[model samples]
Target: MSTPESCIVAGQLAELGHTSLYDLLEQACREYADKPAFSCGADSVSFTALRSHADCFARYLRHEAGLQPGDRLAIQLPNLLQYVVAIFGALKAGLVIVNTNPQYTAPETRHQFADSGARAVVVLDKLVPLVRSIQPQTQIERLIVTSLDDWRQPQEQGDAADETRFMAALAIGRTLPEIETGRGLDDLAVLQYTGGTTGVSKGAMLTHRNLLSNVLQAVSIIKPGEVEYGNEVRVSPLPLYHIFAFTANCLASVFTGFNSVLITNPRDLDGMIADMQRHSITLFTGINSLFVSLMAHPQFDSIDFSRLKWVNSGGAPLNLSVAQRWFERTGSVVREGFGMTETSPVVVASTGNTPYKEGFIGQAVIDTEMKIVDDQGQELPAGEPGELLIRGPQVMQGYWQRPEATAETFTEDGWLKTGDIGVIDEDGFLKLVDRKKDMILVSGFNVYPNDVEDAVMRHRGIRECVAVGVPDERKGEAIKLFVSLHDQNLTEADIIAHCREQLTGYKVPSYIEIRDDLPKSTVGKLLRRVLRDEARAQVQP
Candidate 1:
């Protein structure tokens, strides 16, 4: 009935030794002291370096600032070494980390600070002014800033008018005695916020046990034999703010003692490939659009792929063509996983070297239980689409400080309502249908936007696109597509015909509009809400 790894996680927590985030870090530091833990630009921190830096920052928080356990530490940086130092340091200091999106506006940043009640903020130096202007609105006390251009450069002193540099915090902390804090297993470790149905960011209170469960679940999914410990070279382009990359790439790689080369600007296709080639990357993780850009780059073909053992896709759905091209070009099959911020981000992933599945995300990850349920909350049969509910150790404790919201999200039986529509095959591969909120009702038929978008993307002329529901007099709701093209000559009729070959009549976009580009989130996920709003506006009187 259940997958093989499901039994492993459900009954094996005691077998895994770590008690908290600090425990995991200490174990890695002891085992791989001199091994490279993280790299940004040209600089790297060994496991011992990571431990020392984190300990130093923790010392400053405890000895210098007098902060106590359960204090929130807000981190607002992209994929940089400072992010690692601040996050690990915060965790080691027994502080709950609030992973703020670096692309957030001043208002958004201020909201998170106020909501999380963060005492200290570790941010990119460039964004300090933005935070400074809004500092009076929150409870911020300490401001640790660092330049992405040079995180490793030592500075004994920082800007007197503002606050200390990220490196200066480490220097000051090192001079103090060891930080005397180690939060236990049930203590909160992270506050990864996600926009729920209310359209407001609600923090997910992920505990130390939740993160440890996910780290081990993900590591089990990725066999040790497939990736060499302390020797694997991984090119991680995803931002650490997102739970998917935070747990899978940053946390997992560090726990395994693998060297991760963090890319600040994954949009630079040439540079991402350059980093990959330089590291002779054994593992690469990215979204569908990022992989597409890399494949389209002129220099992508020149990169060596002899050592590439894995290519992972998450954060969004993996397009079939992108997966096929990656495998054909690099001889490394893409493993697509699925999860959300509340689930510690990785609950399912395709096993090693598995060939591409058209719409399948993967089978259930270790200790994770997923099933489909209809409107009445009754469980659905395998292969029947319905809202997916999940239960596992990796699932979050609850939404931070929102008891009512958290209660509504979980079933009385304890399953987390995923708010996503999907189908699980008899063999356990989970195939995504679409977000429940984004489903279009054409007459009596249910049309999933992802289905239409996936079919259209296979046309070769379509470079990127999003599908949304529009009002229709007869059908109640009709499909409208916004797409950007790879070929200037491609026409609406060409797209319509391509859809006819792969989808049913109601599933095809009734209106196919081409554009220079579609609006997307900072993580490159197509903003379906944007397109949906635009579609509704066109129908307004």
Candidate 2:
């Protein structure tokens, strides 16, 4: 499946003539000049205005801020109209955007700023206090602060000691002359940090070519005639800082001309529903947990999904029950996909044409290649579960400043070693088994947490659950299950009894903790490492 010529064809799918995201943005502005590029709350920007604003900001970076090509600029904001402007503006200045999560704590924020050597940060006003404290500790020299309401009304320029307000920067930027960056494809564009699920967070270095290719790859999955460019509204609830949303929603919108409705706070289900009601949403992207949370909302049935054409699930495993409930209620199948931050996020996805099947992640997109390999690095036969390795243009150059890690992650042949175990069928469809690191050993038996969790999710009373391996005396390691429930009446014994019917004795949880909540990442992916750490700490030495 992975031939040199096929790879060339895949890269060509993006029409490299556009070269970089900056080129694509320029083309989008020209082609869809008057179209709504992005909307958040009451503010919306047309492609023409977006280009003008971006140009102004780019000028500010070059002349006022003295930022040059390849300089790292951190953007710490929610899904606001300003976020879109800052992205294009930074790109125009040839700045590498370090997408920092707005909710990041002081330590997390400091580490990213320090690690990436960010010279400037565009942060939300509320989060400025944290950034203020961490600024002196890092190389950050400029602070461009913005508020949620800043887009609605331009704030008067502030003479703050160490910062420039966002509106003020744009106002100042508008007067500066545009600087030709001469930056394009193959140049690093973003430093997307991994979730640090395994250990410390590291930035995945993504170039323009990597992201652009993934954008084309994602758009290609729609197939021709499925979408009407410039006539679609995408309801994007995922955080833009996440690579999944960065490529699939933000970057893809540039190429497809779809107006993206940025959901600033997806947790506010009522507000999200209101946004959905306001826009005739044609595309929706979310993780499995978000889908479940939305379905459980009190006014879920009140929202109109009649215009919804496609619903995509990624970032985590899609539970069969959640997917089924979504289809039954919304009449849209929840097509699942698999991606990693290192791959500019989208490696494989289930398209609209794919049949609805449990655990099916569909096939690799136009230019990507995937193979299953055993512990010895030998390729596994079709239908055999093993570690999944990927090779594609979308794959990142490497982790930033972590040469040892980057070296360890790639094979001598150039395939990226994805720690997740998966099986590919003869027909090319893929099914994820579990993370290789998350695999549990129970008295000489190999137990995958996904299998155990999938079985437990089958019970009608369960809302969400995660399985982790804990140190066991007799068994090498035992499964520990943590769950949040729909029916509070269901006890730990009931879950165990139910799992017993579906899984073998060793696969059943040795202990069940019925909690009101479970630890989750910002994206709503359950943090098995957090639970595992807690479980191990409780065990006696």
Candidate 3:
């Protein structure tokens, strides 16, 4: 058995020069003034113009909206140019950004706004009614709404007492004097909320140091792979609200100067493909399910993938079958990485030069330290899977306004309890097992869902699959697998027979169900919790 010191691993450290996100943005604007920074559909904005617009919005927030420094501002919208403007503007005004998912329900939206104590909200016009229904219940005093095409034309203020169009705010802001925001690295930058798969979503209090360090760490790892500064075009299909995209795509762009093509509706395969053809993208960021869906598109093969340098897979586990299919089609190996909303999101990643490995998730990223520990909080040796603990500059300060929850999430020595089960090899490569909470016990034997799901997905007929444990009288818990198949002729018996080849007796699924499509999040991560609840309900009655 190895000691704790032998088990701990650290990545090469990277230095962060910028004090805050504002400082980084200003530097990018100065260096890449005329370069295109972002594009949505047919519209594009240069770095200089982006800075001008952000300044205008920041002035309006300070002067007209009466939002003071350190105020909480909830930004609820999809992937749009307006999102970039709003986020940068909020940072410049010294406001803490509360990124809200456009796909969230009214209740979910209200909880975030109310919990964060947000005083103002910038929401999509289409979802205005949902916000209005719950606005009175929240602390939101100022309302800023935007439409899909609002950036193209002037917009009028709404009839509501405090409702102002997003365009109108920028317009009003341009007339005000430049306001100085006295913010630093220690100040809170964003209130990034968790997925709430376990319970109520808690906002992870991310500081400027936390986020900026991550961007630098990512740049240090990626630049050595020959990714040019200020030259590459990154196709960003993931939502910016998710931390995976927030830091990796948006914040990282300020430093790398990559022109990001925002795909508002990734579900629109035709539109996404058209944009791919138009941008000649060099970098791509997406999840496993999306890779499968994109390859399934008939026109997918038509796009030229020669310029594609990197295809990053995060937000979900990377399936070996899907990764191979992507590599075969695009001639680019999928660089798998792991992160969460808490760590400013980039703890470990496979660099551009790293060779493709089936189940390996690379190593701890720059300045990050990682170790595996047992339930007793004692460190585990190499090859032994346990809860992964992380300590890094990118780790969040704490959960917002929840001391008890925050204390429970961290150890006394300050390592963030990642709640993920992973194994670290002697070479420091990590293979994620599954979420600690999702582990199943079958007659005193531990069975990981990822082991079963990965085995099930290898079958040629299976399209997508999720494994969850359900209650059983005989075994205490039984494995239940849900799958969507490419071939309708394949039977549950076939899947069972296939699993029997790779998985142990207790690990093999006891129940199998065929479905047309499984529940998935907006980012295309399989909603195992949702399916688990449904499966458990069915078994109960």
Candidate 4:
């Protein structure tokens, strides 16, 4: 039993006994005050500037918004300088953060707000309409609307009726007393939501210790490859709302004094390359789809990859072809990791300059223990595929407000039951086998078939729909939809357009097939497995 003190005394690692994330951020603000903390387009926020701005925002949250400690603040915005500010500010104000995807539809936003019982929301101006339409259905009261122009200093503010200005909050925060965040390590810091097998999003209650430990664990494993005294410049194209990016790129970068570049849309390979070349980024965090997109780009080889020290991929399985091409194009290996929201999103990761291997997701990270278990809760032998169970300081407290689901998600001794089936090799490497749930993966984003089906079925013309992932050369898996329509006149394009409005782009089905009827069980329940097998059969040679 290594005490937190002993761990710190044993070696040089970031101390994990802080009261909260704000405690760590306050320290970083003092140590790397002048360094670039986060950047988006032409706007860059220095560590010192970030602290001051967050202070102002926190004061406004506590005083103006009337939000008290432990109150949940939902942040719905893309990767921008404002996203970083609001995250730190919410922590400084002793509020729990519920990261909402900016691309979420109105119904999704409503569900998250209603489930989390969020009182305040900071949203993008373009997304305000969605929030506005759903506010009546949720507890959301305080509305803070910002724009892309708000990344820096906006010359003219947009017309937002009954909504507070983001810059205005910062200005008011400057005058109010500094927020005294009285949070303990055991206090809830974030409510990271992930869709269950049922397609209903459930929030994972993550305490400060959970996240702080994960950050320290990550920092220790990656320390060997990091530049001396935090000279690491990281390029982050993934959404910060995702737990993987939140920990790896945002929190880790701030703690270690890395210059973090925020890429809003990586689909634009030209823009992404331009930013990468501009920063001479040393560390890259992306998914298989992103890596493949960059490698296939015309200007990808033209960019300098000599400074690229490491490339970390997660969210989806890394294909050998993409990894090989990435290493050949850039002089860096693609190290893959595996995790879930309940584990603070990191369970296994390749560390240091270790030779990257296909199929394997590296050894368990620092202070993290994992095992393979059979259905009877018995441990499996090495090289045997079973449900992967994880126990670590980084594991979440459990699903928020869902005791039964939480109980079912963990073993009697408290190991988190990662729904992923995996086998651990004799050398302690973990290789995934399959997903126990019928969840679909599209471009590294989890797309629950039920969620997509539910959205499509909302259309009056659609009687029944089935969503499944099919093999994609660019994305590891792309969604294909099978539909039985009440109105035969409805075209695939019509249903797709309807779905585009209801779901995010990634979750939208790329291929649609008209079906007379969908396979169903004797009890009249939709047999998703039957459809999945049929789809796989179609793709087979």
Among the numbered candidates, top TM-score falls to 4
* Structural RMSD, model 2: 10.4
Question: TM-score for model 2?
Answer: 0.81
Clashes of 2: 0
Task: Give candidate 1 misplaced runs (Cα > 4 Å).
Answer: 1-7, 10-13, 160-162, 353-357, 438-541
* lDDT computed for candidate 1: 0.80
Please give, for residues 1-541, the per-residue lDDT of candidate 3 as tens digits.
Answer: 0112211121221233465688777888878888999999999998889999999999999899999889999999999999999999999999999998776666668889999999999999989888888988899998898999987875876758899999988888988999987688778999998743344568999988788878877776674757888999999998898898999889998778999999999879899999999988899998765787899999999999999998888876666777788999989988888887888898888976555455789988767889999999999999999999998888888889988888888898888987889999988889887666676655434466776787788799999999998866435568899999999999999999998775556678999999999999999999999999899899941
The local distance difference test score of each candidate is 0.80, 0.83, 0.83, 0.84
Per-residue lDDT tens digits for candidate 4, residues 1-541, read 0112324312333334467888667778778888888877766888989988888899999998999999999999889898899999999999999999998888888899999999989988888888888999999988888888875665235365557889888887888986699788789999999988889999999988788887777776665536643577889999999999998888878888888899987777888888987887788898988987887788888888888887888888888888888887787988888888887878788857444566788988777788998988899999999988888788888888999998888777778888888999988899988888888877778889999998998899999998987877677888889999899999989988999998988989988999999889999998878887788778721
Tell me how far the alpha carbon of residue 455 in candidate 1 is from the true structure, in angstroms, after superposition.
32
Instruction: Please give the lDDT score at residue 519 for candidate 3.
Output: 94
Each prediction's number of clashing residue pairs: 0, 0, 0, 0
Per-candidate alpha-carbon RMSD to the true structure: 10.5, 10.4, 10.8, 2.6
Off by over 4 Å in 4: 1-17, 155-162, 223-226, 353-355
Please give each candidate's TM-score. 0.80, 0.81, 0.80, 0.94
Model 3 whole-model lDDT (C-alpha atoms): 0.83
Question: Of models 2 and 3, which has the larger TM-score?
Answer: 2
lDDT of 3 at 314: 81
Order the candidates by lDDT, highest first: 4, 3, 2, 1
Which RMSD does model 1 reach against the true structure?
A: 10.5
Q: Point out the worst 10-residue segment of candidate 2 by lDDT.
A: 1-10
